[model samples]
Target: MRIFLFSILLLLAGCSQTLHINERYSASGQNSRVQYIVLHYTSADLNRSLQLLTETEVSSHYLIGDRTPTIYRLVDENRRAWHAGDSQWQGRTWLNGTTIGIELVNQGFYDTPTGRYWQPFAPAQIEALIGLLKDIMQRHQLPPGSILAHSDIAPQRKVDPGPLFPWKQLADAGLVPWPDADAVARQQALFSASLPTVQWFQAQLMRQGYAVPLHGELDQATRNVLAAFQMKYRPARYDGEPDAQTA
Candidate 1:
């Protein structure tokens, strides 16, 4: 009886060890604590973009192709991808730690010799993005404003998902906060009046969750933040100057 009991104990211990090993492997291979969903443009074709994201050091959680409204999950939602680098938003830096990045295939911001520019994103691609974003937002309980662009967070160094991105369409779909046009028009009187000091503009940008130094000077960082805001809101001109309309 004693010999039989010893053998049974050894077998139970081995099973427990195996179970612990399996659990460890599973946890190490997957992602966790996914919070924000960030949008980006690959600036490359679909095949090349996928190859680069999967094989190269750069990767995203999801990739949307042109002409098709399907999303390719490159990295699992639980694992961290190396997409966002040197980013900041709402006074917080290093967005990769808290965001899931989505890369859309496109060649953004091509300039012509005649000073005209071209930026094209297919309708199917936008549709795919909407669906994917809806799923991610629901799963993670992310707020509508948390759905951000790479350029929105890192304006100085990145411009993916550029001005051509139809942010208004997303807003119309109840995916994000569209600035109240009436409020903007009413504020236009204040903006068009006396040229507000750089301090005032900096405060506004800070209140809007953009990273800017409160030095009261219109520095490059301030210009970048203003340009990002105008790209999303004004859209007509994003020259970074606090003109009568943007002041």
Candidate 2:
């Protein structure tokens, strides 16, 4: 009986060493793991999109269909998705670990005489997306600025949810930020006479959450990042030129 009691005490002592018991509770500061919601275009049809997002390596938290107004919840919000690959945003890198990616089923774009023509998202599809965004943001306590484009995070390699996307509509709905027309106009006028230097443009791009190279030269990488920004804001034309409108 004494041996049994001694063995039990030894086991209890070993367990205590590995366990921590704290009963104090405070409801003060709190935050969620989710920080950003990145949007993308599947660039494939609905069936193909479902296949790629499911059977293949690529995945997303949600996918809005092109034809049907169905919002497929491919991955749970609490889990990570393999959507944003090698991405960075506002000094944060490898966004796949920290962001919720939503893929929209659209054909992306094709070049034409007028310009690069990107397929417009269906109204119902966008409505569904807005609803999903509202729910996710509300649950995660995410701000409007957290809503971002996949292109915005991976400028060097991506430009999906492309220029034809109705960013203003989302902005109006308070889902994301949009530049004030008056402010943009004033800046355009100021920069029209002489566009800002490459360094200045790079600085502004960084301020807008793009990871641009501050080489003071308009290199290809810088141009790609600028084009991604223009594609989101001033989609009318994005020749990667640092012009008044682009600024």
The prediction achieving the highest lDDT against the true structure is 2
> Candidate 1: where is the Cα deviation over 4 Å?
1-16, 19-32
- For each candidate, the alpha-carbon lDDT, in order, equals 0.82, 0.90
TM-score for each model? 0.85, 0.87
Encode model 1's per-residue lDDT on 114-173: one tens digit a residue.
Answer: 875646789988987888888888888777888887878888887667778899999998
- At residue 93, give the lDDT of candidate 2: 96
Clashes of each: 2, 0
RMSD of 1: 6.0
Model 2 Cα shift for residue 213 (angstroms): 0.5
lDDT of 2 by residue, 1-247 (tens): 9999999999999888956778699667868889999999998999999999999889999999978979899998889999999999899999888999999999998899996677999999999999999999999999889999888999889988888888888999999888899999998898898888999999999998899999899899999999998888888877788888887
